[model samples]
Target chain A: MKNIVIGQYIPGKGLFYRMDPRTKIISVITLMIAIFLLGSIPQLLVAFSVCAVMMWVGNIPVKRVIRGMKPLIILLLFTFFFQIFFNKEGKLLLDEVMHVTVVSVLGIVLWTIIWRLLARIGKFKTVLLLAYIMGIFVLFRFLPFGYSFTTFRFAIYEKGIEMSIFVIIRLVIIISLSTVLTLTTKPTDLTQGLESLMRPLKIIGIRSEDFALIISISLRYIPTILDEAFKIMAAQASRGADFAEGKLKDKVKQVISLLVPMFIIAFKRSEDLADAMESRNFVPGKPRTRIHELRFGWTDIGVGVFTLAALALTIVLKVIG
Target chain B: MSYIEVKDLSFSYTGKRMILKDISLSIEKGEWVAILGHNGSGKSTLAKAMVGLLEPNQGTIAYDGVVLTNDTAYDIRKKVGIVFQNPDNQFVGVTVRDDIAFGMENLMVPQKQMLEMIDFYSEKVGMKDFLDKEPSTLSGGQKQRVAIAGILAMQTQVIIFDEATSMLDPYARRDLIEYIQKLNQEGITVIMITHDINEAMYANRLVILKDGTIFSDGDKWSLFKQPEIFENSHLELPFSLKLAAALDDSLPEEKAVKDFLWQSISNT
Candidate 1:
């Protein structure tokens, strides 16, 4: 849970980090639009390069950006597999008759056992995964022995490969653009920026200040609430509640034990917090000053205009294509 | 007139059971008072009532002669600040600096002055270096200090610590006690609410509460004289006070026993 980097802010002093959070937010959104507008390979290359340059200029390490995408890797792989296998269009690239015979089945079982045994060795995980995928395909294609039970045809097309690559690249571009925003801006600043951007909604009687306050408070308490939840789980575990090793019915009961205490603690905390806030003279919906006031600077203006122009150019190129 | 006066105050959450019953107390400017009680003794309710967080069912609380009501509560809050027991719950700001700024912001302090006060008060609480650090990353003691810094930045005349040190370790609690003593010495009226009698001993005046009423209230020495009150409240005397009591009982005179103990210490 700690490794989840979506809202994590890495403190740094750089051009992108110093820009007003609103500008950074706008830039991220603009780039995301540009990424989707991109149609051809060259356009995608341009979008990817822009994100790379933004990461570099922001002093965000390439490794950190990749780390942020770790959880989505499985989803990306699934999408890739689904797109290539399901979509049959354009020129055919591969057509093979794969046999599911006894030897092939035995080979797959042996490969699975070896993969499970070596899975705990973290350094060889990528190599082992690649082998695990390729070895199954190899066994299905070449190893035909005993009595053949089934034969299935495997095929791949040029468009399938092309669309899969495009989809993966597009997702990466969007994720990296947003990752740059979260990594550069503080959580407080992000909420403040959102409030600032949503100020125009005041005409419709929407209170953005209150909304931002809610978000910021939630962000501030997420870790604390999570810590309390884990503590409750531990306490329940000590009292003969097995949250992990339980039947579905028993698991629900165990989870209820955890949830009841958590809800009680959360309510108690909010009550205390309200009292404390009142003691501090915080009147809801009232005007309040801020310590770190956000003001646009030259860099913010420069980035804002640059992103707008880039977005315009992308739209133009899309129309032309 | 007293700095704060609570008269004939009674309160209850459900109205079925009275949490505080006819509680009347007064604190003077620059006085260090400790309100001590065991669990569910209504000590915390009394503190909250004084700060106008909870209204009394029967009587009035006046700060500097102005009565505390719903309308005046917001105004009175500017002069009084409270640090709650749970540090994580009361922390409203994302960073230490913002936490200190929270109160001042609510009172509409200017941005420049707010920054200056954040720096000055954070330094006073020894949290100057941690101004930008998140509250979650901070230790329990550090969060309390940040809370104190926030209250101090608001420049409140009266600061209430409602069992603030209860969640801290012994070392952190002692450090905080020393800091609170220093703050009281510097003329901030300090009202410390705690279940630990030893912690209450640091204050000049001690008020022991039992069963929703003030069981005993007096100067420290006077409360020490009434050992039965401590026993009734399930509070133990500090080791030094206990040793002094033993010596006074065994020896001929209290002064003679103190002199003997001082002489042995000086000889060593």
Candidate 2:
């Protein structure tokens, strides 16, 4: 449960922590743009180095940032595989044609059964399964003797692997930079900074202040609602709701049971919150003052300049290369 | 004039069934009053009506002679604030300091003054050091204390507590009760709506509700003298009060019952 650290603010006192929130927000946006705009390996290396230095200077733990990315591991892997298998623009590293025979089919089946039996005794079952899949691919490439219909060709290209690496690096840098922003800036400041940044949109009647309020409220209540939902889930589980051990349909039914109660609780909470807000004299659209005033300092200016320069360098490198 | 006056107040949620029926009560300045009742007795409904959260179907509530209507609700709100039950639901800010500042911010308090008030009220509630702490990390008692501090920061003259300690543990409830008592001592009018007779005993006056009507209203000692009324209303008596009533012929003074019980227990 504690692993759900995405979008959560970690209190800190690093340089980025003290830098103005507007500066931090702008810098993060700029860095993200630069990362996506870079075309060559050298540009990516530069951007990655900048991210690494930012993580170190911001006092952000690399393990914590990686843990924040844990939920996206599957998606990252999918992107990597998609790029590797589909992008065919470079020199072929390996190409082979093979025939399949009955004996090889039997051998492969026996090997899978043995591996499954061995996997039962393994501590890292997932790692073992991945290894088993890789072994199957190697077996097909080398031995490749099943039936004639099962025989085919396999190829690996340099461009595919390079494209996959680039995509993965882009994802990592974007996720890491955003995580760094959240870790250093408190949620209140983040929202306030966003509100200030979007204040210009108020001329078009966008109500950025209200939007910021909504974001802040949502961020504040996500963990709280999750906690409530977990409690309800536990309560239902105690009453024979088999959320863990159930068929797909049964699990979905259990989910609806949890969701209905959660929605009711959320509605009641919003009504109560409205009352509380009114009692506290909160009238929407009225000018309100904040206790914490945001002020830009020298560090903010320096960071702002550095981010802009980095963005320009990436664009120039993209064009020149 | 009474500090708060509610006359012939009747309210219904759907206009079909009455939640509060022709309830009339008045509270004097600096009075510590507890509205006591069992569940579904409409004590909370009355508290909401008094605070202008729910408009009565018939009758009027006035604060310091100013009538509470649609136009005056905001002004009355500035003078009266409520700390509701379910501390997590009432919290609007991510952090303690922000929560305390929320009310003041809505009132359009200047930043400097808001900071000073947040500091003062948070310290008064003993939550000064926890200003930067997230609300999710705090205990039920601590959250309620922060809620009270938020209300106090508004500088409201009257503070209505709608079962504020019902969800708290014993120790937290005691801590909250002590704070309420201290606030009353400091001349902040307190109207606590609770079903706990033990908690009701801390108040100067008791208003017991039953079936959407006022069943009984009197000073605490006088209310305790008539244990049958408590039994009729389905409210449990505190241990000392129950013992005092059982040994009625011997125990003359209601206030001495607690000390007597302590002495007897020590001797035994």
Best model per DockQ: 1
Candidate 2, A1-321: lDDT as tens digits = 423453667766778888988999989998888888888666687778878988898788898898778778777878987887777788998777644657666667877998889898966665676677677676665664545557776676899889888988889999999888887887778889999999999889999879988887887788789998889988987998887787999988888899899999999999888888888888899888987889999999888999999989888877887
Instruction: For each candidate, give the TM-score of chain B.
Output: 0.92, 0.92
* Per-residue alpha-carbon lDDT of candidate 1 for residues A1-321, written as tens digits (9 for 90 to 100): 333332768878888877999888888898788878889766787778877887787688788788878778777887787778888999999999999998899989999998988997766665687779889999999988888999999999988898888889999988887888888888889989999999999999999999988998888788888888988888877888787796899988888888898999999999988988889988898999988799999999899888999889999998999
lDDT of 1 by residue, B83-121 (tens): 999888899997898889999999999999998898899
User: By lDDT, who's the top model here?
Assistant: 1
- Quality of candidate 2's docking, in CAPRI categories? medium
- Collision pairs in model 2: A100-A146, A101-A145, A101-A146
- Each prediction's DockQ against the real complex: 0.63, 0.59
Q: Give candidate 2 regions above 4 Å deviation.
A: A1-10, A66-84, A90-93, A98-134, A150-152, A156-162, A203-205, A222-230, A233-243, A319-321, B222-268
